[model samples]
Target: MSFSSLLASSQNHLTPDTNNSLTYTLSELSSLPSTSAQFDVDGAYRLLSTGGFDAGKFEEGIAEMDVGERTAQTQNLETFLEARHSAFINLSLKRSQELSAAMASNLTKASRASSWSAEKKRLQTSLLGSRTYQPPPSSPSHTLVVPSTPGLHASTWSANQSFPPLTPSTSTLSQTTLGATPANKVLWGASRTLDSHAHLHYRHTILNETSTPPDTCPGYLDLLSILETVSPNDLATTSLTWLAEQQRSIFQTFVSQKVTSSSTPITSTDFQEYTTSHNITSWHKVWLALRSSLIPQALTTISTITPPSPVLLTRLKTGSGKIGYGTGDIYRTLIGKLLDFENIQGDSPGISNTEDYIFARLHRLTRGGTVRAKKEDLEGLKEEVLSWGVKYFGNVWSFGLPLFCAGGFEEGISAIKESDEKGNVRAVSLAIVAGRRGLVSREFYEEVVVMYCRSIEGGSPRIAMEYLGEVGRERRKEHVKKLILSTRAYAELAGVVGDDGERVGNEGESTPIDLLFGQGEVRDILRECGDALGREGGGGTDAAELYAMAGEYGRVIEVVNKELAVRVDSFKNGVEDPQRNYWKIAAYNFAEKHLNQGRTHVIERLEREDNLKAGSTFQLLMNLTAFFDKFMEGKFGESWTVLDSLGLLPRTAGEVSNCVDNFFSLDKVARDCMGRVVVAGMECLFNLHASLKQDKSQAAGLTQQGSAGGQSLAQQANIDHDKAMRDIRDRGRLIVTFAGLLHGSLGGEVAKLIARMEAYMM
Candidate 1:
């Protein structure tokens, strides 16, 4: 609450009585609540002026208003304001601290010196203010009565309520004697010495959190006492909720234990009873039935012995919290995707009646629809355009257009349709909408589709692509293909729209053939965009992403392969690239990204079935990806085995010549990729060779120093070492052969590496 509001609350304290004299009325004001934190000066002064509490202070029967006495009342008002301000600041400090600082103190106080409680009490009183509690005069014997401050009795507490009792015989109250309460509950009391006012102190801290020096009543007695504070209905409801939560918690624990340990499965209890109590009968029985059916299958998993400390973690959430597990997004997104939403069908159900949901999806999609939005954020925004062709009409389209503009999809078809819909849309668009329901024929689509795209506010040809995309399957591919070629002519005329330097436009208007338009590509228009996204500074598979969109799957492999080659091309063979593991993931997994999967599969099938050249290239990419995956996992032995199987690392003299012949005959792109592969293969061989020699030397020394058994083991080791060394030398022959066969800088580099390996062999 604001300072003004706190002061304004004082108005509720008293009513003006014109008949009362100043002295008697002043005495009445003294009876007000001690919590003068809500005292309002204007309210009190107005009442005084109207004879609510005498017109002036210290006047008694004097007819004239005394200025000096009035000044004292003004000082008192300042004091009241100070008290409220100080109290508010102190409260703010404590509240902010309670969030984190209270957790800072270890479970218990470090020191238990006698002065600890006294000092804490002094600190609380100084910060919060001096509380003067007067024991009710009617309390039982031995309770001291502390006089209450004048004028602070309005409604702080009723006079009839009993004061917090204390053992006046002792100087300090034992924490153990206090009644049980929840961890969060608080009780306030002040201590005063009948000896003097100077010793008075207020305390706020409870017995160092969690460590309650025990001596409480029986557990049931404590619960009964606590329940006395709650009404019957509230108590019943709270108890039911607590019981349900406990059951759920136990069930979760059982599931966790069964999943991660050799714990026995929980018995088949009637869990539906608990759910039915709360009316959540939707899937409780089904879940129980499934559990019963699957128990035998789950037995192997549950009974399997495993290491401890493993847990099937709870669902991950953003921040220190997460949205409930069940409310996951129902619709998949399309923002940066290269394909349309197909009917594999897990689309989120959006009711046309839900204006807010529709608007929310639109608000994000059209704006985040820009070229530069983060892919993750864009993934969510893609769910928006799914609302398109769904009951969107009239003000909904027009109203959402500007928001779409702000989001940067200004030249989008929806924006164009919204602007055109008034005459062009309300009638023509609605006709198409009606036609979509079989109200119109194929002729209707051919008639307005072109004019419809042209008539939209911008007359953007790219809008034609979106409209054609809405056509039935037979026309969709052909219509979109022809339109993609048409966009090339308009590409030059279409200027960028947004802010200076930003891919500009407003009201969701972007330049001609923006990457955001239908399934996110415009072919000939994308040619420039694809080139622009190509790996700058020789990094990333972004170029490959666009190629996948434009049906240039081969080009996608080439682009991604270039990055992979650079990433795997070590300064020294077998030494992994300095780039992080994610670089490899992006390059190798490029085919699996959104919208590319189905298209990638199509290309894979075609390449394997008919396209020999592309098929070899795709197979090579798969080989390189597999080799590096093992290499990056620190599994050099497995990586070498992969390279060997692919014939990149030949073991025999005849195999070496065959590998070299195959390498030299490949296309330039394939050759460039192979050159890196061979280099990495050599480095890995050298790494293995060097490590083997070290282990053999250690075994030789151990054998010379040990018993006859050690001599026998050493003889076996020497035989294995000779055989492994011969295999290593055979693989190295490929590098040496390439050096003499190809007289280039690469051969010279290879020749130098072979000489270093020879020294290690010696």
Candidate 2:
């Protein structure tokens, strides 16, 4: 018999019989003999054919057929002609059969059910032909027969097989409903089911109306395209809808999998990945979404909010999500909405209740500054924040308040010099809190001093300093003393701090406030201030302490400048502070500790400058010459060697040489060299102009007395000299350019200028 006839005959057994003798149970079939005996038709044909032709190829074929048919239909409409409709159907069916068979095998292996029965049922239920295959008649002799050919008479068939009866009244599902089970649903098909994971479902619902099996259905790629097309209206709705659905699925899945619950909390990682994948546009949205979920305790998980976080919250308040979206666009629309909300809805006292509700649920403190509050509204915000702060962080500047305050302070201080009003206030508040709590660090004190120095009014720094001392009291006094000692230590340790090292003691040096309060003398002054504040009323409680701190301040200067006078009495000699040392010893200690021979330059320059009898020019020359000597030493390593090592010598050699030719050793050259080099340079141009005019009488021949030059031979020599002077001027300009380049290479303008001078002399 043909394979189709055998398959047809085999499935015929599914029909209920009145007599139990004619049917066979699966158990009875196991007892049947295995045979390679070829039926009239090939086994391959039986596997390929529809009917009991149940195969994996059928489902895949169904999907392929659906795609081809729909695609062809769309193509037909577009081309203004019908598709080769019959030919396309034929192709779809063929592909459907091929794919269904392949898919069936895989589904069967994955299901791991008894026999190939469940998969076969799923496949059969999915196929179009499985609905129609009918059984051939059985003989009265209790034999099963197979026909040899298609549509041939039953009389031509031979009865070959018989089976025991299937148990009566046992229910067998219809083909369609068999696949209706949730797990049996085809993915991205009209009907689908939950998979093993149970977290993600095969959602058969279509996102786009035009999508179908033959069509590429909506998926991640489709979502991405939708995102591209999102506008202020429809796209936002769609993106939000899609994201909501996705989040819902994730939530449900996670719950179903026991990954999260009231009893078993979700991890931060789960929340992070779930939120991150959704293409959320702003930090506010991220915050809202995550805040809606419970915070996970997992340390490895990191959740970040988008945007200016507070600004995002403001935008959310405005209800911009209803407006629209843009590709790679920020939530400006949302922000506008938030501004409107804050204007209308945020004002009423009733709004505080709503905000508080959210805060309580989210484990957030309902603080005023956490949201949008303009300068005028800050007081209200402050009231709200302080209430929340006391409730959540307590009245004292302890626990969460300190951490929160510190961050705000840092941000505020950073913005203060930039003239940010809000930032400055926040910084000031933070500093006060820090000082009050006695939690202030050296860095914080330094920052406070710097801020005071930058204030608009005079003595603001001193006032600020006194305020700190007053509030912090004895603790503040101790800190002030410690700060003086620290500053001394820093100056002593100055060699490592680069050019701004001196400013560590006197930071913001260019600002008048720093000049006033940041000097060593100010340390003594603060001691007095602190002692005065420490007093009970008239004289001071810490009067002796104050006097002692002031004396210690003087001692700091003494130690730093012990070498100043040659006389023995000038030394701190038997001065009370145990920390005091003689000038030579201090210098030796500084030099030895910093591990550099060059520190002596600073000492020598200070002493020579301090000695007024040496004269101002002499002092300036001494300082300049000291700088020159240090530059020649090149503590950072030779500039030429560094450039050569970097292979930049090739590109920079000419510029380097030009700078060298301009700056050094012009004195031996007196007139010629000065005229050719020094006079031509930028710094010497004024001097050059003055030198070129030996006679005042010739000034009239030129355009302006100073503006014109002489043309006579001696005048010409002077003219020639003037020309050389111009060359020197150009050289100076060149030196400036070279200095800039050297700065980039050697690290600073001063170093570069010195290096260029050295190279010029070389």
Candidate 3:
């Protein structure tokens, strides 16, 4: 017979007979009998099918069971879909008959049970959903039999087979209810029982009549689409229904694990709240590329009480899930709902019940600054919050008051330490709390002080500065500076911190830096600021002073040199502008300030720098200053000793190379004025040479006037003239070598000055 006809005939071919018998196929009959062959028509038909029929491994499974136990079974939908598509083949050529007509009937009945139930499930879905939904049966089942060839009558078939009694359960279950047994959970086409995990008959994947979303991970759902299509009226009913199903499944799983009732119950609240990157935030367009969208609408819809009602929002906001930081008006709404605020007194008084403390503390925390209240009233209110905290030390809800109170500071610190030891990640909260009561102490408070400071540094430092006065005066100074520096409040740190440690700027945000840091501490802070600013393209004259005050004379000189280099073009043109001398004057003022502090601190600063050549920075500063003074005074020769060392006046071939090397070796900020330094050095040499030649001519005139008396003076003066003239020749060589070395580097303006220096040599 054909496979489909065999399957159909197998469905009801057996009869109930007391005497059991086994029928083997021609192949099996020819071999030695192995364990008296039992009958399973369902298994035989599946093994004979052409298509992937019953590919669920059902044939392999039912074929193994004894006739007495293999009567009928059913399946649950999720499990049926899980196994239905699996490719299973049985190559064994053995064919057998059904044990009884009941077993034969129930097997097909099991497959039929889930086919229709799954139909009800797919009815609402439109797009993609769980891949586990039962696929349409690829091979149709039938009830009629057809033979492939001319067949013999019943006599031949009867000789080959015998019927057996049906299983006891086969008699118990009718056709439709056949799959209601406890085993239905394990196989296809079975229904869920009371013992199953889900209490809900099905998880609804539909939002409305026209809209059915995929059964997706909770976060992936298009929540706004759900809200918009939810008819506005149904939001009341469906808003949190998903959560109920989720919580029920959790409870069932907890029970199934055999956890005792006395153990901590696993509720939905116990899990960390679900948040997603795809979340739509509140009404504000926080950014152009990213912003809050439907969150405000969802919050308002769920929280409003006018028409649709706020039964859901009230539960979430008033209960543990306060999605506000996301709070202020949120807490006010919730707290107002919880209390008769009109009855609570806010005067200079104390508390009697928990309601009094709750209202007073929450009000102070959320609205104290905005509301109109007397000074004594606010102070007395905060004091009461602290008093109430002592009364209920373990009441974590009112920690607001105890955090600012020094009375129980030691206990609070201990609790924070214990939390850290337990590996609990309460970082942001612990930091804000530590920052508020900014005290550090030894003895009872000593052990916790470091942990508190560390926690403060680790978490939201922005939350701590409000009550900064509570910190010990001595510790506050250092801690405040660290907070400023770490936050990169460089501009604020640059503001003059006086000897008394008060900041000079009027910016209220930087009041901590001003109030807590003294000049001594600020010197170090400024040094770091100067370096950071210098790297980010020179911090200008202000940055130079920062370096100067920090005793980093090299950077001080480097910055001022760069600053004065900016004015080199104007200086070369001999432009008579006061502004041209700005950085030059700045360098002088810094030097005088150093002198006023005792000695010019350049020598001391240079001594500390191990990498430096001891006098290089000091010489740069001295030459830069003296060059500024004497060049302005038309007395370049007076400053020539220091000026030559500034890498400006190279007098030999080797000196030119050294000058170029030093120019490249300096940082970009320090390189800014190098070309100007060269131009200025050339001009100074021409002027110094002229000054020496003029002195030589005056000595000649003196020698001619007083032959005997001025003879020795003129001889000594001519000796000096010969030496100075030789130096001028080397200076001329340097000018030519530099013009070649600098090629195109010194732009059009400095190129003209170098050309003039070469022409002067001619």
Candidate 4:
């Protein structure tokens, strides 16, 4: 069979058979070349498995065929496939280029259309002018207009062409009926009309473009009508858009009008008129407009207005309710706006004294109940006023002090301190003034004292002392103590001694130390005088006198035992020797008074002193001291021994009489002393007599209860009793003699007491 015949046979067998199998004879397969031979099997297998045949792979397989065995049929098939693939690629490339060109052309046309539309709008506006445009109908929603010309290049549009203005009949165009027209397009077409209306309204009202008041402007009336027609939600949008167009013109006109009326200035009436004509309803809007426009001119105009006087400022500070302004809020806003204007423009020549103007205004605003000034604003005003005070008066305290007292007490103090070199005193004075006015706290006065102490030296103490006195007057004990301590610390720092009573430098140079030291010296002298009187134990002296005298005497004797004695001796040694005897008599009288009064503490205190105990006069003083102590303790027997040791007891009646007689010539204190001594002696004699009588009675009882031994004891006891009785009698007689002598010497109360004692002894 031929190769074509074999190929046709394979196709027939592969197509379908009764057994569903392909069979080829060996001769038929061997007739084809080997490389070409696999083609039919591979093609059939590839088509069945992959559902398609790869042309390239089929061609590659053909190239790989043995050169000798490769057939013309395979070459022809590969060439046909390559031609078909190339044709398909060329056709696709041509179609893609055509599509790209079409898109590019469409983009170019669209760009031209956009540019032409913009140019058309610009030219139309220029040709027609803004005045000829009419606003769109008022509606809740915005409307957009689209050009009706389809596929018309925007660049070819003529400027002379105009759209018919909307009549009242067409004014009700609803958003639902304006299908597919964008809101932006509608706004753009109507922008000129809106802008023109706003401009006309602003010019007529704010700028007075018609040479008539805003109240009579047709454009302003139209705007007010429009505002009334629009919903509140739309009003804000409408007003804002209107304001956007007229902002620059309105501001310039407001400023120009203000500048022209510099003398009269724009008052609240002017603002009211302006707002009414322009349909401005809110204070917030007014504030915005003023802030945006007439700030500088307003500042100048406000500065020309006469500043409120301090009295008016004070009244306004406390008075409530509106005066000329509408309400507190409106008044506050007005003042705030004026203040803002002034601050922005700075100092104005309209006011000769800018600081005074600011101060007066600030005082009104801050003190007034209507508005509250910020802390920074108050401080800034204070500084301005303080500078003026310092520059003109050469002392900030002149103004600063008064300002603080008025209302800015703390602020005034701080300002003065900052402005003055020697501001401590000024600050302190201001604080004191504030305190006096009850504007400052007790702590403020204390802080002033502390500041003075730490910052100043010499005069600080004196000033602090004055402040302390003021505090004392308030009965602020704690504050007074703090001031004293602070003054003391300052005195120490200044090297001031408390002992120095004289002024350290000039007459006014005395510090707290001098005052304190002088007070102490006076106290010492008073104490010494008290001690002298106390030790003398004068007739008229009470417990207070005795205690004071004892304390003083204790202190004196502590210094030196002989110190007190020397003082007394000096008084004695003077030509007036009677005074010397008076001193001795007073001292002796005090001792006798203590002995009679049963007071041993004074004698005990005197004997306890080491210095006095070691003195040369210790023996006499001790005997005298012991006599009083023992006598007061009811140790009459012991007191007698002390007196006997001192040789105070007279050896005979004549001597005793003489001693007592001499006491009468002494002063009252001395006489009292002698009288007490005689009384003590008589009491001691009476006690001895009682003891003698008891002893005699006991001896008789012993004798009565007798045996031989008892009898001997009784006899001895009787002998002792007899001797004691005799001694008692002798002592009694001696006391009698002493009393008689005292009765003779002392003629007043002393003599009377001595006579009583003599009678008792008898």
Off by over 4 Å in 3: 1-511, 514-538, 541-615, 645-648, 653-659, 666-670, 688-727, 742-752
lDDT of 3 by residue, 135-188 (tens): 111112211122233322111211222211111111111223322322122111
Which stretches in model 4 have alpha-carbon errors above 4 Å? 1-400, 403-634, 644-649, 661-674, 704-723, 743-762
lDDT tens readout by residue for model 4, 605-724: 455544343333423443444465577667888877766655444656667855554444333333434445555665676676676667667777876777655664436644665666
Task: Return the TM-score for candidate 2, rounded to 2 decimals.
Answer: 0.19
Model 1 deviation from the true structure expressed as Cα RMSD, one decimal place: 36.6
lDDT agreement with native, every candidate: 0.37, 0.29, 0.37, 0.37
Can you give the lDDT of residue 243 in candidate 2?
26
Question: Where does candidate 4 clash, by residue pair?
Answer: 116-154, 116-155, 144-186, 317-367, 317-368, 589-673, 664-745
Task: Provide the TM-score for each candidate, comma-separated.
Answer: 0.31, 0.19, 0.31, 0.27
Segments of candidate 2 deviating more than 4 angstroms:
1-378, 388-487, 490-492, 496-762
lDDT of 2 by residue, 275-349 (tens): 455554343343233223221111011112231222222222222233233443333332233223223122222
Q: What does the lDDT come to for candidate 2?
A: 0.29
